[model samples]
Target chain A: MNVVIGIDIGGTKTKIGLVDEKGKCHIKTFFRTREFPDLDDYLDKIKSVSDELVENLDKKVTILGCGIGAPNASSKKGTIENASNLVWKGSVPILEKLKERMNIPMRIMNDASAAALGEMLFGGGKKMTDFIVITLGTGFGAGIVANGQLIDGYDGFAGELGHVDMTIGDGRLTGLGVRGGLEAYVSATGLKRTIMYMLSKYLVVSKFRGISYNDLHGEDITKAAEEGDIIAQRAFDYTAKMMAQALANFTAFTQPEAFILMGGLTNSGKWIMEPLESYFNEYLLEVYKGKVKLLESSMDGKTAAICGAAALIWENEKS
Target chain B: MNVVIGIDIGGTKTKIGLVDEKGKCHIKTFFRTREFPDLDDYLDKIKSVSDELVENLDKKVTILGCGIGAPNASSKKGTIENASNLVWKGSVPILEKLKERMNIPMRIMNDASAAALGEMLFGGGKKMTDFIVITLGTGFGAGIVANGQLIDGYDGFAGELGHVDMTIGDGRLTGLGVRGGLEAYVSATGLKRTIMYMLSKYLVVSKFRGISYNDLHGEDITKAAEEGDIIAQRAFDYTAKMMAQALANFTAFTQPEAFILMGGLTNSGKWIMEPLESYFNEYLLEVYKGKVKLLESSMDGKTAAICGAAALIWENEKS
Candidate 1:
């Protein structure tokens, strides 16, 4: 069985796993991302852990390829363009650096795009020829798969659905040189902003009050909604509506088979799912109304990225 | 050389042509669409015209295929769903009917889609893999080609760029369910409406006042614009701005090599092109900025449908 290393790099943690041609994952490893002073150090730590695992095995395994998923990884440039979370400031040549270190073929793509490929190759969208994978996390991200291929557009920035102006939300500052975008209202910050707006509007008090958005986390909001918190429910509802509108607009151009929602924030489950499903259907054109299935990511937490990044190698081999 | 019979059925006219493998169109024919009372009559007229053309040729030119481009033609369903402009009242099984009559394989697609295929096979996009063809004629229309193949979406309803919202003009009604679409502000009706608005706002003469908009045409507006009419020029500018915004949104999804503008309205040249080129650049995301080109379609007032529809047969042979 041809096996490949799948690495997922995130702001808080990093996940590494071995995925085979059958899309099955083997022993997995995790580490805090902050410990490494630089990207090279981080890569070295990953290599050391992998080498140890390979040595411990009863027989030497044949590693065919490597696939990495990072926040701003560019498939066209084979680089990780300045991710706000990572230590790297500018365009970091990830694929080339990894190739030099490891004597195997390596491919890198954006995490959301990797998730899309994972869904396409092994998960919910396996039977689908066209679909979109939306990551409802820190920022709403999208990976578009059209006609059985990922759309990288002209500069590999084709699936930037989050930045499409669904409605100019309260002007919020961001590094991408825009104050308001669809991401501002539907992402994690958008959820926090919604909570604050509802609290101000309804004059409500909450246990999660006074916590910075980053500290509160998506799960906390989910917990609040599950506990029947009116403000939290409202926040989820608002996000779902905006999300539906954005998806509806997107459907106008590329009608897909399904929209797979991923990331930590969508863990809110029914609070977000039910409303998004209802509104997305409501706004969809008659032809597309019942056609698109809304699905949860098959990969969860570290496993999601692991499977997604791993699937990249599986796909590269086939293509 | 393999050849196919290509037919474009429109509201008032039908265009028929014989297209060979090399995209060479021979012996073009045209007739009033209303001359036929039923589908059989239309097919008979096509057969007679086609028979007359091929009879004189020394080679026994067996028509290898038949391709049709019509409004609301569903490539997936092999039918032309009832178009409001056509005399037909319900879904017409055009492909199957034509195939049986000609004893040849047949395919049908929406006019814009056929135009996109035409551009891919024979027009400005002949040398390119991915491009969008926007037909600015009686209605706002588009055909998108990505990854060297036409994007039919899930239900064969992709590339509806004309239906995207217009930010500059009064929310105009469109044939599609959506209001304020690009069609409302950029097509023939859109141009007339803009002229009417200008007349009310700027023109004081009764000669250009209180006339039903249906009475005015794109030619009249073009003549006015050519004569340096301020209101007419502003109308063109407004149309260009709205179109540019729509194109910007489209580029967000599939970054094509260029946006090829076709159809009647595009004939206005600089009046439409200048604003569109400027605004498209201004609104584009940083990554796609200055990357996508805007070009005029070579198939103007010609058998674009014939060329594109013929391409279907030619494409099948090559594959």
Candidate 2:
């Protein structure tokens, strides 16, 4: 009857779940993060939701610990620091404040890394010792696992693959101001940008021509590409090429057995995955050729966030 | 007394040292490697040198085990696989054959990774849990240490930073056939190549115009730059720029406390170091700007190889 609270905090919404050791969420609750911009109000809401979830349970159960996954979070500091996407601007000591409200032991980490640990414990990476989990959403994030353990070096800031200084790009800047960075070419935002750029460069007709920059999505591109749109096909090709280069370089760093990818960008399906595999092999060093594999995520986005959060507690507790 | 045999194999010569647990080389000997094209003869010479080091000892000593560091070596397979620099053509099972010849326990690893373990045990990285060691002699190599352990992923080929795909350069290719690789612009041979390329592209007059490509060395460039030669200074500046870009990318991957550099390129002094520091800081992500330091290798090249090899066995034995 033991359970842990897993919280996945987004910029707009926060999802909370009561999870068991096998990564199943028995019950779920949520609150709007933007609605409670005040720190006290936000903390109060989080406390109320957590308390209500435990209180409403019909059967007796033991609450073990709490795990939180959020943007710009540091496991060492137990806080989220300068998370641009979050309503809370500066460092928020979520772990300390949450522990004060609930007596359970709590741990916090960057969402990407939490997902990686989840993959390690329950996903396709269960049997692998060294691998990287890439999240290609509004931005690109990576969770690096080496020597069979999750690595969060120097205050949980390692494996920021999105911000890696890059050369293959259309001179667009990353959210961090790195020109031609990997994220500038591979993220969901990057896909929209690519389609826009390709439309301007090519003389061919396409469905994406009139759409504004932010209005375009990966799903639209996928549908158009399936219907035989050359511009859409070209965008996926270009994005895959840059991602392949980044993955190829990552191979030299960790020499991972495989690269497991997640996020909205994966929805592009065969358009990106096929080229990613081919280009990845082409760019790999001779020693690593025909060895490293590009894999799809076994968990969906929402399930990954919640399950990964829960796994963080179980992963540490078991070890 | 108790000791271990540390063998550091090179393309031209091989060094054999009888090292104690404290990392002191009690007795050292050597034999020509390129001189013995036959694998059997090379193995015999290595056996004789190791035997001589033990027999010639003035005091009674217990030989515990053996550790070897060599090019293209795989610790898992215990073989030197297709090393272009060595006379042996295919996979030479040095570990198996050496075990048959001597009957003592032995371990083998790549020289660069061995130097990293050497640093973790006896040099600047001793107190650090995460760091990278960069060897920039005739070519570039890297030893990555994370979670206070040396990492050699899947067949001992993980830390090949020299072969990381690069974006900056004057169209130079690495020995591994990688174009614009990090090694193409950061080693002794890199310096030579840079000077030649600059002389061809620029109209600047300098002291290096007449020298043949094979005759050039890092020392000559260091001397010329010290004497205020413009092209020499430019070569160092360009090399430092590319190297800094690489180190910045490495920081994002490992988030190491520092980068410890060894080999001939460090001798370039302020010419490279000053620019390297500035460029690295400028290129780093905002969170990691001031956190990573560039440190000189505390152990010399020869000491690093032997001591690191000895430390390999001692490290495993202690743990």
Candidate 3:
């Protein structure tokens, strides 16, 4: 079995794992990503940890490939372009740096794209040829799979569905200067704003009071929703409607077999999924109605991204 | 060189032509399409005309391929499924029927998709691997190309850019029950409605003073705009802005190489093109600004659809 090492870099934490050809993951570990001031120091820690894992292995397994999943990691450019959340302000040659440390072939792709690869190889989309993987976390991200292949456009920058204009007319303003996008209404950060706006419009009581915007998480809102908080429920409802519209627009672009939901907010389960399903059907073109299916991601948290990166390496080996 | 016959079936007119591997077209002819009630009669005429063209060939053109472009044509199912404009009330086996008359293989696709393939292989997209073909006729239709291949989703029903929602809030009812779609505002029929809405809102005079809704065409308005009519200019400006927003959303999904404009309304040239270019740039993402080029279709009139159909056959042969 050809074993590949997978790494997932995130703003909060970084995860490393060793995966074999059968899609089994082992030797998983996590560390704080904010500790390092520069890329070299971060990579040194990665190499040291990987060295510790392989030192005592029986028969000394050879690493066939390495794949890293990070924000703005581009497959065509072979670099991680300036990520918004990351402290770095310029493109990072991660794949090139990793190549010198390990003599194996290495690849890099955006986290959402990697997640799509993971889903296609071993998760929910294993049996499907066309589908979309939507990550509704701090920000919304999408990966499009059509004709049994990940749609990496001319510059390997396809599947940017968060920016798809979901609202018409004087739409909600996007941070990118465009108005009314899926990200502005459906993302974790967007949901909090929705809740705040609803609070101002109507009187509401909460378990906690006087908190910073950065302190608000999707879990806190969902918890309040579970406790029969009307404001929280309304926030989720609006998000579901907005997300469904965006998905409907996506369906118009590519009639996917299903839409697989991932990331932190998907944990809300029925609160989001039920209404999304209803609104999706309501907004879908007649021919597409009752045809496309919806499902939640099988992989959870950082594991999905790590698994996806390993899958990319496995795919490269086979190809 | 393998020569193929292409047929473009429209509500009012049908075009037929012989096309070689090099995109050279000959034996072109056109006739009224609605004269026959049954498709079999139409096929009979096509057979006679095609037979006459191939009669005196030195070598038997036994390997002649055929490709048909029709409204609502499904590339995957090989049928024209209930086009309202056409008299046919059900799915028409366009490819199968054509194959029965010829010894060689044949295929069929929606006219817009055929146009996209034609543009990719023979027109503005000849040097492009990723581009979108937007057909500006009775209704706005788009065909998407990604990763150097046409994107036909699970049901072969992708690239429905026209139906993408551009309107937000109330007072908008879509054919799909969704509010504010690009087709709702930018189609040729939609343009006429826009003109009528402007007339009700502002004072205007026109040669089309007595023209009925059904009688109003994109050409009449194009001529009026050329003659320095304010109402006509306003209608084009409004439609162009709506189209630009749609294109911006398209770019978000797939950063295409270029957008190739085709069909009847694009014949208006600068009146439509100038406003469209400015609006597209206005709405484009900062990263993608000035990256996507817009070009007019190299194919003209009936030949555009014929060439598109032939291009499909040629592509299938090479594959």
Candidate 4:
């Protein structure tokens, strides 16, 4: 059996897992990403944690490679470039530093691209040649695949679906400071914005009405939605409408076989999916109607990111 | 020396050319497509005209294949699906019928896709692996190239840039019966719509203000703009703004090295291109700003369509 170490590097936490070839996590561990500010110490921490996971594996498996997925990662340069959320400044030679500690056929890519690779290799996109995997977290990031290849354009910065302008005149601004962008209306942050808008528009008594901007999280909205909170439900519906319109536009661009949704907001389930499907079908071009499908990522749960990261190694191995 | 028969099928006329390896047309001829309503007769007429053009060449040359770029074409199924503008109803087996007469390795695709192939093989996109060719004619059609391949998607119905909904409320509807589509605001028809809007809104005296919607054509607007007519200039500026926003959105999707403009709207020259370049730079995402170039298609002139059509053969031959 061949297994690879999968690392999911986030702003606050970094998780490493012993991932089998089939994308299942046998063992996993996490460390505070911000705890070690020094670059060399961070590398050492990652190596120790990864080594322990491999040693803890019950079966004697060959460690083939390691794959890491992070924000602002540049696969072409083998570095994470100016990630706004990370404490590390400038272009961090992460892959090089890690390779020094553990010499393996490792690879790194944008986190969203990693999720797309996961979807292709082990999730709903298996056997599918063309599709888009969207990560709807703090922002709307996507990895678009066509001809069974990732579209990492001229500078390796292709597939910025969230930033695709699907704006209504008075749409909110995104974290990137772009106004009227799709991410401004469809991301986790966008969902909160929707909830806030609804809270002001509708006079309905909702549990979220008292919540402050800093206090609100996507999970609270999902919980409220599951309980049939009117404002929360309406917020999800509004988000879905924005998402559907954007999906329709994206369909016109690539006309992918399926659109797989991932990350925090997808937990809303029927509240978003139902409205999204109907609106997407309603807005789709005449020829594309009843053709493309909208699917939620099968690679859900905490270990999903790890599986997605590990997929990078397996994908490269095949190529 | 080798050559290919290039056929550009249009609603009114069909042009046939003997295109050499370098995409230069040696000789060309045309026949009214509407004259022969019968599909069989149309195929016969095409084959006979093609034969004459091939024979007229004085120099000895090998006929490699035949390529046709028509509305509503399908390279996968070898048919022209119900093209709303074309006389043919339902799926007409264009390639199969044409193949029966010539018996050469023939292929047919959507005209826009053919133009994109032309770009890759002979035009502005000759050395580019990733680019999008926008054909702004009566409608906004496009052929998107990414990862060194045409993004024909799973259904081969991808790259519908015209149909992409970028609607602000009150945006005009396209021939596809879709509102807020890029075609509604960027095509030749769309330019007239812009002119009409400008006429109604602006009190500035202009020649086009007296013309009816039916009487006003894209050429009139271009001519008026060249003469420094305020309404005409404003219309071009408005069209460029809409087109720039659409292009910026498209950039977020594929992030190409350049956007090659083809078809009628590109002929407006500086009236549109100057403003388009300005707005494209202005509206482009920070990551993509100053990177993508807005290029006019090098395949210009009466022979342009023929070159675009012949490029299909050369593209396939390369593979």
Clashes of 2: 0
lDDT score for candidate 3 against the true structure: 0.80
The parts of candidate 1 lying over 4 Å away from their true place are A32-37, A56-60, A82-85, A168-175, A197-216, B35-37, B56-60, B165-170, B197-211
Candidate 1's docking class is acceptable
Candidate 3, after superposition: displacement of residue A60 in Å? 3.4
The 10-residue segment with the lowest total lDDT in model 4 chain B: B165-174
* lDDT (CA) per prediction: 0.78, 0.85, 0.80, 0.86
Query: Could you tell me the lDDT of residue A13 within candidate 3?
Result: 82
Q: Mark the 10 consecutive residues where model 2 chain A has the least summed lDDT.
A: A163-172
Q: Candidate 4 — which residues are off by over 4 angstroms?
A: none
Q: Which pairs clash (backbone N, Cα, C closer than 3 Å) in model 2?
A: none
**Estimated TM-score for each candidate:** 0.91, 0.97, 0.93, 0.96
The CA lDDT at B246 in model 3 is: 85
Residue A318 accuracy (lDDT) in model 3: 68
Give lDDT tens digits, candidate 2, residues A198-298: 98899898988777777887798999999999999999999998899899989998789989999889988899999999988888988888879899988
Give the runs in model 2 whose Cα sits over 4 Å from its true position: A56-59, A168-170, B168-170
Candidate 4 Cα deviation (angstroms), residue A49: 2.0
**Tens-digit lDDT track of model 1 for A48-84:** 8777656665655888888888887788788887687
Q: Rank the candidates by lDDT, best first.
A: 4, 2, 3, 1
The digit string of per-residue lDDT tens for model 2 on B59-164 reads 7889889999888788778999888689887888989988878888899998888888878877888899999999888888899998777777866788888888
Native contacts retained by model 1, as a fraction? 0.52
